[model samples]
Target: MTKGRRRTTRDADHESFDTAYDAIMARWPDGTESLTVPTPYGPTRVHACGPRGAPPLVLLPGGGATSAGWYALAAELSKTHRVFAVDLVGDAGHSAPDPQRPVRSVGDLTAWLDALLDGLSIGLPSGPPVDLCGHSYGAWIALHYALHAPTRVRRTVLLDPTGCFAGFRASYLLRALPMLLRPSARRVRRFLEWETAGGAPLDPALLRLQERAAVLPAVRPVTGPRPDPAALRGLRCPVLLLLAGDGRAHDPHRVAARASAVLPEVTATVLPGVSHHVLPYAMHADVHGRTAAFLGPLSRPSR
Candidate 1:
């Protein structure tokens, strides 16, 4: 691949996106309103479910995951909170992809989200402080937002956040090293299967999205050794950390212990036998109940 050369999606990619979009939309509640929030780089797509007047809550999926990654579980989430599921930019969702200017810094990602919330009127000025939840890569993103933009966030939920408390396993790096050096369709499929072995097959759109992400020359902006103990200590809002038992991405138990010690207001839960990829989707009702209990009900500000 040439340095200046950009990777454009072929026709097959379009087909995959179309197929996944239909499947994803079918899973959403009957009248989900889709909105496009404009950003400096481009537009981001947000899928709103539940009552419009309900407390605004944002849901962010893991890296290479589309907005619908939360489809199987969004229903339960929307029951108590107005869920604003986001199709993060630079990923395979309907949002625009700017490979030439990949979000490389945390500030860039934060500002992108700031514009999104402002566009949706999802915070104190408009209503109430937004509640944020993220899984895997998204958990790291959510944590960053809470730390840097404290005023905008209320309660936060981090589920098996990658790179926050612990780094990726050496085994994962070793297994993925070959794909990094020479990414191919077959390798991508194999990696996906490995990550989601017990779970169901990913929607075609997300599969295609991950395929493109695997070969991208530039890296997406990600959370580094962030939300460190110092940052965690400063957070005024409560944080819920859900750990996946026997997780390979990070040591869940270790993270739970560390977070408990450093954060003033934090709760930790470890789900037995669950892995990194198998998240709230695997136990929708259980996760939903816990999330609702932790967050309680939304309280809009008075006029």
Candidate 2:
């Protein structure tokens, strides 16, 4: 009888885990159009814009960026495609706790994304295969997802991807060391000027937004796995890789060549005189127009 009671308690504990996982998955910002889809890992949040009936394009933001990061891109893409920007789980923004015990390694990241897509009902018999666009670390996620779930991905665009270039390493010290030493407005202004290279001036409000984002509690160090050349070579989907030619750390031409050499089908473009941060703003209109043209002829026919 004691053994039986212990077995019952164990079952109860397992049930508790399931319940907590479910609750965490379901917790998302209220009033936003959200879907809680179950993945192998955990539930994921999918935020959308544009008509539901249109073809789907998934947007993956850079590290520490939430789904809101793709606001401008989504607004532009939504004219033709149903845009869904996903907040990567276990990172900043609104995403459920990872289902896997200890979310480390490239395989784990791929599995987490697979679970996210499953949870969101992203690709299925009724829905169109996804067209994915990812920026920076998000690009790495998109690339792995395509490799793991090729059938579910129709086309992929990697915007200012991080792992492709050895030189483009983003250092915490580069951003943090200065802030720690000089938190004054003058220092911040100087930093901003240096960061932007006195190019187009950023709106004061936009600068404030960047500042607030920097201070978010969830923003922390992220260690990324090295790129797998073999895996990249194996990808069969159509790919578009965009790089900013004038990015401080990344060499756009070299990175583009490396990506093009590995990906089976690829087109690489470099926007001259643009930095990593300014790419979205400087090349926004052009990229949007070009992307629309690229996807228009290729996207699956409406049912």
Candidate 3:
């Protein structure tokens, strides 16, 4: 409706939404407790797991990816840290779609997140702001939130974040252009295939579910603005940037060098031979390990 992607009409919204929501919930790792946190935009869905008292870590998925996308990583990381994987509002997920208040700017994006955090008791006297981990588009959101609301964040982990350091490659835009122009289950599958081409094959079942959701008519999702250089250079909290060597999403060397030079406290690591599809064995292990260490008590606020 908005571009190449087919927007699911109101008539078909219920059936399609139920199926996609169920599939996402079914695939979640054991012990994940699903909850809906109310926000001004709508009710946001989150998958919470791990010890209640442990330091909290919020997981945000990439463009068109669901909370299920974080299932594997969350399952592994939850052993030490409480993990909450959210289906970003306005995306094709259980989170209620809101075309009315679309997150077109950094202010809009951060406002919705601030409301969601308040709903989750983050930054309150009893609840402290948690660490953030974002992939692709979600990484963009995490970065903005950290810049705009530094006091609420402990640290951040960005995995293959596109658009922060630079723009998407021409090839990426070309491949994605089709889906935005003429969205179909087939094109969605094709895009997934291309994204997972080298690193690791995404879970087949998850891909199938996403394909269905993509074809269903739904509200177009948010497209965040590119980060400003001044904000990127003035981050208050520490951050960990994980780049894949062969990933087309962003230029690894350039992003790392910029992060080292611009950011106050950052650890940049480039995993050799890893692709943009980071959920695979090697990428997941390295990214998760580094994130866990970064999210450890050592990084917590000074009491």
Candidate 4:
């Protein structure tokens, strides 16, 4: 007879987040390949797509997200630019594990990005610099990277970015509390299924893939200190803030207003009828067109 499987607290927690992640991944599917870049910390795996000759645009996903999160947007953007959709080093999806040292602060995350880009040999030629587009927590990382390495970035876009507001709101905390408290796979899967189907219907195959990737064991656990807004004043790149029309947790318009006031070179736009999670779908075309127009004139020919 087969022995019964053991269930422990750690095991339960692991299964929860794993299941949730798998569900989310099931909804967003792509055939992009991966690359491993050797860094002082370790080898970082980056998932990418797009034609090799096109201008480079790096896409970063939200918290607990993978490069696949950019599926809808990258597909459109890649038509005109080489899109490098990266799995945030320590979070979910296919990024290599961090070194024995802990990634505890905003600076550490920025350094990790620098090492990854340097190792990948991106942004050296033409002196044009790389464009960064990040959603949610990834936006925070993008902004921090721009601040840390101003010369390396040509332009930056923050899509429904989190942590840009003065503080995390109560509703956000309430929603996040469940994930923090249980962090279970089943719960996450339910959330993914809901999110995938909750918005305007998406492709069925993409939804299935998102569900599978969400439950993988390799997804990183959430940790580390919160970011400080004081960090925003340090960023010196041309910034674009895209606010979702139906943003509820933090007022997107308010955030955009504040960001525009504080960020030296900034532009803000609100996409009507788009929810935070569904902004990519609603704004993908507009973003792609606008980005191509913005970056085309800026990229310099290699001398």
Candidate 3 local lDDT, 130-228, one digit each (tens): 788988888889998898888788888988788788777888788889988888879988876886677655666677667767765555655655777
Cα RMSD to the true fold for all candidates: 4.9, 9.8, 5.0, 5.0
Poorly placed runs, candidate 1 (over 4 Å)? 1-9, 97-102, 196-219, 298-303
Query: Which residue ranges in model 4 land beyond 4 Å of their true spot?
Result: 1-32, 125-127, 189-235, 281-284, 298-303
* Cα lDDT listed for each candidate: 0.75, 0.65, 0.76, 0.66
Q: Give all TM-scores, in the order shown.
A: 0.86, 0.74, 0.87, 0.77
Which candidate ranks first by lDDT, i.e. highest? 3
Which residue runs does candidate 3 get wrong by more than 4 Å? 1-24, 280-283, 299-303
| lDDT at residue 127 of model 3 (Cα atoms) | 67
Off by over 4 Å in 2: 1-43, 96-102, 169-193, 198-206, 219-224, 281-283, 299-303
Decreasing lDDT order of the candidates: 3, 1, 4, 2
Stretch of 10 with least lDDT, candidate 3: 276-285
Q: Residue by residue across 177-208, what tens digits does model 1's lDDT show?
A: 67667876568777766765654444555565
Return the lDDT, model 3, position 136.
80
Clashing pairs in 3: 4-180, 4-181, 5-180, 7-217, 7-218, 8-217, 8-218
The residue pairs found clashing in candidate 1 are: none
Give the winner by lDDT: 2 or 4.
4
